[model samples]
Target: MYRRTRRAVVTSLLVSSVVCGGAVVLAPAAGAAVPAASCTVTPGPNDTYVTISGEGFTGPRKLNDGESTVDLAIGPDGTFLVKRFQKNVDYTVLAVNEDQNFIFVNCKKVGTAATPKPENPQNTAPAQPGSRRDIAQGRAAGNQAGTAAAAKSCTTKPVADKSGQQHSDAYWQAWTQAANRSFNRACHTN
Candidate 1:
């Protein structure tokens, strides 16, 4: 209930933001210069290097060691932090929600966020070149690129299940998550 309303609100706020993306694909903004895009994460729990450059944002901007929330020029004209988030240190990039709000960026820092994998308090290792994890990550990035495209142009088909109760709650829950992820991957940001 709460999430639904929040997503709706967030989505509305980011309407003018272009939500589209991958490792480092550069694309032209509607009427603006081609925006640089990428998220670089320097490994460390405290001083993780997190820089995001995109269309409306300032380029390759360097973040402080403990910057959780960053002010960015992300609006239509590309100047201002329309949203107010604390300047704490979190591993977030320029990624944003569907409505384009920066508050819901899905940056999953190693130790701070919830996860099932063994926690790494030290944000060690920049992505390796050709390791298994690296390969999987490449695949996931490619898949997410496709998914983001499909989702942006993809329309939601009506659920055909007559009972309505047959569908698992997980499906309902994940729908928004998928959309947000796709939006982040494709255009909103890193």
Candidate 2:
């Protein structure tokens, strides 16, 4: 009996409040929609490599390489680049943002063949002999090129401390480590 009376009182109060314009309603603000994420896969120099670029990812994101589905962090400018990704092998890049919005980019032409072709297809045009030393030098040059690209991508502004003062040595050390990690990821040096 007590429970029934309490329920009736609560219902009457709610109805009266609404009728007397005492009720408050909430609504979402207009134009608060988030921008959509997008991604692209493009062929790199001489079709030897592929690059996966993404934009509009506003937060930490995951990259699904189709096969491996590894999670990769996106950059601060709502963009990320996977440079020098090897070509001649099928790859579907999927970028998923924190909100679960995703965009898939297919590298159909870049790596469609089951059996990969040679990196240099100028077999008929050139028969120039090369020594082991030349091969080593070529590898070194390629590494340097990759490092250069990674350096460009890894450049970042120094972060101010929470108190808006100069950062401590420990903070700088952590920042440098993070930058190094980003460089390694971009250049595949690690």
Candidate 3:
């Protein structure tokens, strides 16, 4: 005699557990199916700033270079820009986007991979007290301070002098001189 039997079996993986830094994280049973998020890396002026733009991201986002990380300010449209990003030499940047349900990782290389050597090692000496570099830095600082002072002193914006429907070189020169005088007085006066 032969007897037939039926059985019910559950074979789906309900949840997955991952151990991270002595912490156990239970994965979600199910989530919405979506395409992986990505970002574009663009090197800015002298490779000092890096602009990252993309879409379709949620939750937190950041840029990492293994040792340090910078948080990205994501807009409502999912685009981000990293102004004044300090690029590391010989390193790959890791762009991360973390949502409640998933984590997206993207790797990119920014700036020169090799360390740049000074063209003239002798000329790479530190800036002296009255050196050109020092003067430039001082001038920059003074310009910023003076500009703020001038702006605060003036009730309205300074307008450049112009001829009838046209501006001459002399007029521009005079205008610049006046502005320089104003700034110099504001910054250098005791």
Candidate 4:
């Protein structure tokens, strides 16, 4: 009976043991439901900095953050494993080199799928630049600037005194005044 109990205990202890370099690790059970896969990014060619982070994962996974260089595992299949992360969140390189290298994200979810709300309005694509939707929504990158520039463009340009005729003082003065008026209308400048 004692031997049976000992064997039971030993078997229970071996439930989650992972052997690495003659060491044993008792990993936590995922509690019946399988966890989600994670997104990962490596520094592409000419990338001076890179990182990844998201739900169900630990601290920031980074290659650099302007503080110091990071030792990144850049294998075709990286050799490190932490807790899993969720899928479909923007993975950005928070703070990176002055010149940014385009980041490419690749991941596969191996477990339960992420459920998104049906017909979510905010899930629609953002307004196109300079489109009516962008201007109305105040999301146009040049909304205010474009309006101000249009105001300037609407006024007719000043006619220069390039008619090589010798003009009297009164004629030159009147021409200057007309030019100033056009300038005021165009730029709202006195």
Candidate 5:
């Protein structure tokens, strides 16, 4: 009976040591950190649009192409409304903290299916130089036609400005505002 008891104690100690070692190994190491927030992107099959969602991603994040980065707004809960992506395009979204380390969310490569390109090409002709009355009338007519065409072709609402530069600027501003807010809140609390 004493021999059996001694063997049981030894076995228990061995088991406990193995278990504790495994737990430590599985746990995150000290100073090895994850971002305070994260994001995910749901790209449509055709790659025309993506809905981005995350937590603590409010403000602006950068959308990077190989050569350049564009600022884009993140909703309060880390959501973004994205559009105008080409089919099969791969993109990366990054949120940078003050320390400059970034939390990156890679978007899936979109497939070319389900969504189709518009059959009717948009009119790109410049407005004709004319009298004030003619110009005003032409502008009104152009707006109406554009609205109708967009409503017919797009599943999602058209972005106010389709020019990439303008869109990028808007996103930059949003991110700046969000950063400022975060800074103020942190400062006040401390």
Candidate 6:
């Protein structure tokens, strides 16, 4: 009876160790698909440009609608300087990075002085040309106009997401390393 009890105890200890050790190996896999970082943009007055800020973003990326893509500056620490933008637009800003994260924002033109129109009941006189508001609108329009020109610049470039398997090995290796580091810190501590 004594020998049998000892054998049972040893088996239980071995089983427990295996179960606990497996957890450490399995934990890192969970974070493999996690996004590295994120960003946000808010539209300014007159629907000119938006102020963008966040972390883990490197800019000079393409901003696209279905028809166009524009290059825009991305500041360090992810803050976009006060910039003028066009009114009532939605943009899909694709970050030019290994992850190919796309940031989206919708801006509506608001709070402009009413224009008088003799041709129709709705006030639609082109917002006074060369006004401060108009200047902002012009700047925004310039960005919209240049999108196609900029996308042409990217024709030879690698897509950020690396859909072609060119960088898959490297990305997976890095992701695994990061996940292991996170798992060790989360599950095993001295």
lDDT of 1 by residue, 1-190 (tens): 4335445544543453443422222234357553343332223333333333233444223222232334444446443322223223333334343322232333333333322345463434434444554444444544554465656554432222325333334343344455446655555454
Best by lDDT: 2
lDDT (10s digit) by residue, model 4, range 81-162? 3221222232322112112121212232233123322464653555555455434443222233334443667454444443
Encode model 5's per-residue lDDT on 28-64: one tens digit a residue. Answer: 3459674455445556544456654455453557765
How displaced is residue 185 in candidate 3, in Å? 69
Candidate numbers sorted by TM-score from highest down: 2, 3, 5, 6, 1, 4
Candidate 6 local lDDT, 1-190, one digit each (tens): 4335434443443455466663212111444652344444555543445654444445655544334455666676553433425323443445443233333332223332343222542333444544544444443433433343334543332122335333234343443444344333443422
lDDT by residue for model 3 over 1-190, one digit each (tens)? 0001100000011112221222221233457555455655556655556655555555466554444456666677655555436444222223232113234344354444453433665454444555555444444444554476576765433344344334334434444555566665665642
> How many clashes show up per model?
10, 0, 0, 0, 1, 4
TM-score list, all predictions: 0.21, 0.35, 0.34, 0.17, 0.31, 0.28
**Positional deviation of residue 7's Cα in model 5 after best superposition, in angstroms:** 57
Task: State how far residue 98 of model 4 sits from its true place (Å).
Answer: 41
What ranges in model 5 sit over 4 Å off? 1-56, 99-102, 110-190
Candidate 3 residues lying further than 4 Å off, grouped into runs, are 1-17, 20-33, 89-102, 109-190
Supply candidate 4's per-residue lDDT for 138: 37
For all candidates in order, the CA lDDT equals: 0.39, 0.49, 0.44, 0.36, 0.46, 0.41
All candidates in order of lDDT, best leading: 2, 5, 3, 6, 1, 4
In model 6, which runs have C-alpha deviations exceeding 4 angstroms?
Answer: 1-43, 46-56, 82-84, 97-190
Model 5: residue 167 alpha-carbon error in angstroms: 55
Candidate 4 lDDT score at position 54:
30
lDDT of 6: 0.41
The candidate with the higher TM-score, 4 or 5, is 5
Which residue segments of model 2 deviate by more than 4 Å?
1-31, 88-98, 103-190
**Which of 2 and 4 is the better model by lDDT?**
2
Query: What is the C-alpha RMSD, rounded to one decimal, of candidate 5?
Result: 24.0
Judged by whole-model lDDT over C-alpha atoms, candidate 4 comes out at: 0.36
